[model samples]
Target chain A: MARPLTLYYAPFSRASRGLWMLEELDEPYALRLIDIRKGEQKRPEFLAINPAGKVPALRDGDRTVAESAAICAYLADRFPDAKLAPAADAPERAAYLTWLFYAASNIEPAVMARANKWDVSAYQASWGGYESVIDNIAGAVRRGPYLLGPQFTAADVILGSMVRFGVSAKLIPNRPEFTAYIAHLEARPALQRAIKIEAEYVAQLKT
Target chain B: MARPLTLYYAPFSRASRGLWMLEELDEPYALRLIDIRKGEQKRPEFLAINPAGKVPALRDGDRTVAESAAICAYLADRFPDAKLAPAADAPERAAYLTWLFYAASNIEPAVMARANKWDVSAYQASWGGYESVIDNIAGAVRRGPYLLGPQFTAADVILGSMVRFGVSAKLIPNRPEFTAYIAHLEARPALQRAIKIEAEYVAQLKT
Candidate 1:
């Protein structure tokens, strides 16, 4: 028998995004908690798995994938039965990928800019600055129940996590569309389970 | 006959990254220039194609994909004959996607942090700081030939463009690996063509 797919995770961190994805897949995946609070992720042992020494690196067989969006995109494609992603030939695939990249490439930088109060010119920053990024995101969520309309895919897992975190932390604008979108995402049983799992892990760490 | 896949582009801009990928694909792709210098990308007409009002939005049939990395990933998968991406089942696919997201997510943000001289904490900014990002990049290119061994995929287009830009601007370290990698990438006829195309476009604009 093959060893189960595993996620190198840490509770309350970006790794939770991967945790949510794993739950959504509803597949049996092992969790190896890297005590980020103790900087376990930066340790050599974990560094071997991820050179960047970041948590949320998913290992399956001998292959390991890091970067939260990449992990979600990888799993979604690897497990087609889960229907967490569009088929490569599907028309929606282009939009699907666009959102995934947008979440990471555009959203994250914009969030950081806002947090750090950086005076980033729109031209200099490929993300086009925080206000435009939020406006684009707001426009995206406003059009639907999800980023790519009716069907929810891993793009949501990637982008939704950022929006959810941003909105909750009072960093992203508290627009009605975002609030509604967060509510919609929060209602997911998989997300609920992931939240419970993180809480449980944190509880155990505390004990 | 189907309309040729169109790339909404701006010479000497991030869109050039998409142009390089299109050239690498060696397919008939139409270029619709959105002059960034004239602020054409910000116009409502261009915004209709890409809500973010950014150039490098690729339009195939009715589907339009933006974000340079997304466009490259989409094209690579869309045209498998180009061999610009690993097949979904291929072992390298995970790493391919990892690098794609890494270039966009990790690399771009790190570049911004460096250019702006922002005091970004590794914990907060998530690119792990500019030094670590460069170290990781240098390590990858040092392995040589290409990002994923012998196969040169769209990951290179996305990341290479950034690395090339960084090195030339002296923003990235003057490491031997990166310098050699840029030289290797520069030798590609497709990149040369892309460069020539940009130069020609600029000349036309000047006239």
Candidate 2:
């Protein structure tokens, strides 16, 4: 039997990336929404599940996985039928891992640095300052309509969400490439479904 | 036939983590050490291997994988005989991925922020600031002799390297847990071998 996938997520958090990935895979999952405003994510129970007390954690049967990027990679591998990732030994596997790690290591930090106005020395910082990171990402997008050139892997789920958030947060300028790239992602039915579901869930909070 | 693993590495850099992993795996690989001091890493030929112009890039035949954390995970998966990772179907797999990502996402950035004196609001920072990240890591270490408890998975290779470097750099204080953990890791034959080889390589450069 395929194990059940449970996602402990919340609105307006990085959990949205995992939520979008779940929607993309069209897998059956129980969404245990933890309200950040209500401090549910910090509760003793959630803390037991994730010591970091962060969202987008997955409970695959008895096991739990945290970190949005890791969760995305795990689910894609777990549910190979979704074709979210190339086969483990596929030639493209290397590129897939590269972009996925880059999203967490390079893209996330770069976004945070820009969003928080942190000053990182260009020589020491791995991302080489926000401007360089941004240019690197831009260069990647200019290479294609998708991150892996043609096939949209699970990397797109995280990277796309980041680009979309960057656009909305005004952290990344709406250059033609970024704008066009986001449009392509938004047009996906899975992303649309996830966004709508999240919007409805968020709306319920007010009621 | 299994493909030859070509590792682009440099001693004393994050590439050391990959070298430690290679030792742990006991895999036969061709070591192409890039002299970072000679600016070999930034050369156009090296840039083709990694646009970031960083060391620790692994080439498996035609496939290339970069980023220390990614390389660790890739090797763990590729060499399933090593049993260095939890099976993809195991619940502990999530925990495995979590620590690996956390090393890159939370710990690395937190250490950099402190080392480079990048000032930013902790709440606004994705890592929730260096203090909290360190506290979280210390708390994790308190859970064990290893990141995943008694059994040292590839996550240990990733975290152990960071802990060792952070302590040496004095970015992380040498607390009881930190010191004990480093001592435990350093005692490993694989780690010792890697360090011995790197030490000799560095010594050669001085002559």
In terms of DockQ, the best-performing candidate is 1
Count backbone clashes in candidate 2: 0
TM-score of chain B of each: 0.97, 0.95
> What's the lDDT for residue A199 in model 2?
96
The weakest ten consecutive residues by lDDT in model 2 chain B span B120-129
lDDT of 2 at B90: 74
Give per-residue CA lDDT, model 2, range B1-207, as digits (tens): 654898898888888988989999967987888998888987999988987777789999888998888898888988888988988877678888888988887888888888877775654555766876777788888867888788787899988898888898899988888888888788889999999989988998888
lDDT (Cα, tens digit) per residue for candidate 1, span B1-207 = 755699998888899999999899867878988888888988999999999988889999989899999999999999999999999988899889888988899987787788888888898777888888998888888887789978999999988999999888888988999988888899999999999999999999899
In model 2, state the lDDT of residue B181. Answer: 83
Docking class of 1: high
Off by over 4 Å in 2: A1-3, B1-3
